[model samples]
Target: MKRKIRVLVAKPGLDGHDRGAKVVARSLRDAGFEVIYTGIRQTPAMIAEAALQEDVDVVGLSVLSGAHMALVPKVKEALVAQGMDDVLVLVGGIIPNEDVPALNAIGVKGIFGPGTATQEIVDFIHKELAEPAA
Candidate 1:
């Protein structure tokens, strides 16, 4: 049997709207991935800490505050500090295209912007996880 991929869906910064995050979480759950959502108003530190505790295979960060450039690095750094360098980090929500490179450099390899299909996200995760480095 294939072990279900464990994923942590986190909302960072002051983004009060979590409808998108909730929908993503449910979609991932429906796709057979175990998902843990950190809810709204979570700091980068809290997100990383929860990721570590959950020992999740992936950390899907939903940031809409335009603070993604600032917060994403913090979460990645925290994960690295905890020796979780191998964990996959995915960013979803409103992100400027230019910021994708920076997030990519910080180990947030997957980026899903607005209007992306839920199945695409699921397929992307599966394909990425199958990669040698993931």
Candidate 2:
């Protein structure tokens, strides 16, 4: 049997808002993915540690504090430091359109903004993880 995909949903930085994160975590859980949700005010290192401990296949970050540019890179760095470079990283929040390319350049495979369908997020994860790595 195929192992279920494990995802670590995190709220990094000072973003106290977590309703969206909870929703995504719940949606992913309902979609048959194993999910771990780190609550609000988590640091990048903390998130990376959680991902490592959970042995997650993906790390989904929810940042609405306008700190994506700064925080995301740090999170990526932490993940890499922990030898989790192959793990899929995703971002969702009030991200600006102009920053999408930059985020992608830094290896964030998926970025979902407000109003994005939960099914789309679920499908993206399924497709991305289903494909063999290059």
Candidate 3:
């Protein structure tokens, strides 16, 4: 059997809402990915540490507070500092198109906005993080 793709889903900063994060975590789990959800009130450092401890293949940040610009890079930087830079990073939530470039420049491989089908997120993770099928 192929190794299951492992994902760490995090809510960075002070975002009190986690319905979307929980939904996505369930979707990824249903799609055969092992998901670790860190829940709300997480700092970038906390997220990175969880990613390291979980040995995840991807880190998915669910941010709805519009602080992606500030928090996302910090998570990436922390990942780099912890030598977890090889892990793929992704973001999902109310991200604006204007901020997409900046997020990409910081190594976020995929960004899913609101109303994006869970299947789309699942497919993207499979395409980007899953190992090639034998």
Tell me, by lDDT, which candidate is best. 2
Model 2 C-alpha lDDT per residue in residues 1-134, reported as the tens digit of each score: 97989999999999699999999999999999999988999999999999999999999999999999999999999999989999999999999999999999999999999999999999999998886777
Over all chains combined, what TM-score does candidate 1 have?
A: 0.94
- lDDT string for model 1 (33-105, tens) is 9999889888878988999899899999998889999888998888998999999999899999998887887
Model 3 vs. true fold: TM: 0.95
Better of 1 and 2 by TM-score: 2
User: TM-score of each candidate?
Assistant: 0.94, 0.96, 0.95
Worst lDDT run of 10 residues, candidate 3, spans 124-133
lDDT of each: 0.90, 0.95, 0.92
Candidate 1, which segments miss by more than 4 Å at Cα? 131-134
Write the candidate numbers in order of decreasing lDDT.
Answer: 2, 3, 1
The deviation in Å at residue 33 for candidate 3 is 0.9
Supply candidate 1's per-residue lDDT for 124: 91
Q: Give the TM-score of candidate 2.
A: 0.96
